[model samples]
Target: MTTSPAPAAPAGPDLTDEQWTTLVRARATDPQAVAKAYAARTRPAPLLSQKDTLFLVAADHPARGALRSGPDPMAMADRRSLLARMVTALDNPEVDGVLGTPDVIEELLLLGALEGKVVIGSMNRGGLDGATWTMDDRFTGYDAASIATNGLEGGKMLLRIDDRDAATAGTIEACADAVTELATHGLMAMVEPLPYHREDDGSLTLLKDTPSLARAVTIASGLGTTSAYTWLKMPSCDDPETVFGATTLPCVVLGGVPSPDPAQDLDSWGRALVQATVRGLVVGRALLYPPDGDVASAVEAAAVVLRAAHAGEDAA
Candidate 1:
């Protein structure tokens, strides 16, 4: 991969000799280390890249405290190991960009992993994984101005509303404003909408019916000041046809909690991306942190699914 131009050093007082050495060490592989030092010196890094779009895996699992997988799952809580896997994945030609929080993005920026590549920053992390607030999603990552300044290509926020819980209103209002702001800055804002409900046992869940998904999509599409820059991040539900009727906006299926049958999950997503308004897939745990340890194969398989959809669009 060709290296994109490094961001100009943040303008400020000169770096001390020790700091300069630290930066040199940071440039080796740790993008976050470099970003932190640059921040300490008040010098933000430059844009990594702005080209291509395929499957950009989301790797923000740590914040949710879901370190383990099914029975044998791990905390996956180690930043360094996470970085290593991400860096390796980013180098793959089939993969385009990454969807993650500021820490991971900055690390990629520092390691030069994002040079001449798409960089999409995750916006809402406040929901935390599996927390009571999981459905109330909030914006805690790069904002509109940050996306523009950081040279990021786009921004994404989750909008999982559980109106029964009374927090859905806030999530809706926040998403509306976020959509407008992102559009005003000419940034692509991907809104992942889910009509969710918490069981009596308190498990956050997605509604499986067509009307529920349809109503949820309608509510989401109508958010913000305009739908021009907005795109839908939907689930691969049983009724893509019914769900597809909910909006004309471009959509992409999401990889929700990994299912016991991953092949079935990918097949479902592949079908939706092909038949409906889906433009692509925004897969997370299912593709990046899979049950098996083979990330490269999983990503390649996803790309095939995406390619088939794109080819179908071309044919039509």
Candidate 2:
């Protein structure tokens, strides 16, 4: 299959030679806007299409402390190392694109890795790493306006609803507003839905239970004013079918922390990705920071599973 040609920079208005030189210097302050404006001034080039592009490599693992597919916990802790590894994986031929937090996104932009790439921005960050406020899940990165100004392709937000947590209410309202803003910009808003459940001790937990997941799905689908750009990052529930039934939006079964058995873990994900509603898989640790050293092969293997499932459905 042929990859889509990258979008040509739009042409900008004519400027004198000295004016052009000054514009290049100003780009450091506002890269996104500068790039778009300059593109507008240039003649259109070969357009890159997004046809048959399905799987999105989720790079949001460091925030969750889920850095390895096996036993290591802090594998993704080193910012520079993780960025280098991600740049390597994303540059591979088979790896389609990436799903990452704003920090990673900005890094990718600076390293010149995002040109002609499918860049998905992460929306939540206030819920810090391994914190009690995980349930609150605030939208701290890549607002619609920022994404537009930066000339990004799409954005993603987390919606883990823990009714017991008061902050969930605020996140919900903020997400709704964000959805509207992102849609107006024609950017994708992939919403990950994990309904929160308080355990007997009162600590917050993600609900894999059927009823709770169904409710979360209902609420998630109903969010924002428009559903055009909305997508679902659903948990692979105990009863996978139930989670799959939770939403009509194109869904992706997230690769949660790896299980004790790696092969079994892959098999589980493979089966889940076959569900009709599950469009693709957004996995991080399992693919990038695998226990084994083959990062490129690991990513390609996961992509094979997703692409096979997606292609089979298309053929049918």
| Most accurate candidate by lDDT | 1
True lDDT of residue 190, candidate 2: 80
Clash count of each predicted structure: 10, 11
Error of 1 at 199 (Å): 2.7
- Candidate 1 lDDT at 212 equals 86
lDDT of each: 0.70, 0.67
Q: What is the TM-score of each candidate against the true structure?
A: 0.80, 0.79
Q: Which ranges in model 1 have alpha carbons more than 4 Å from their true place?
A: 1-53
lDDT of 1 by residue, 60-174 (tens): 6665556654333452554554565676666676666777777777655665566555667788778877665676577777788887676676788888878678887888889
- Tens-digit lDDT track for model 2 on 126-203? 776557666667777778888777666678888878776777889888888888888998877888777867887867
- TM-score, candidate number 2: 0.79
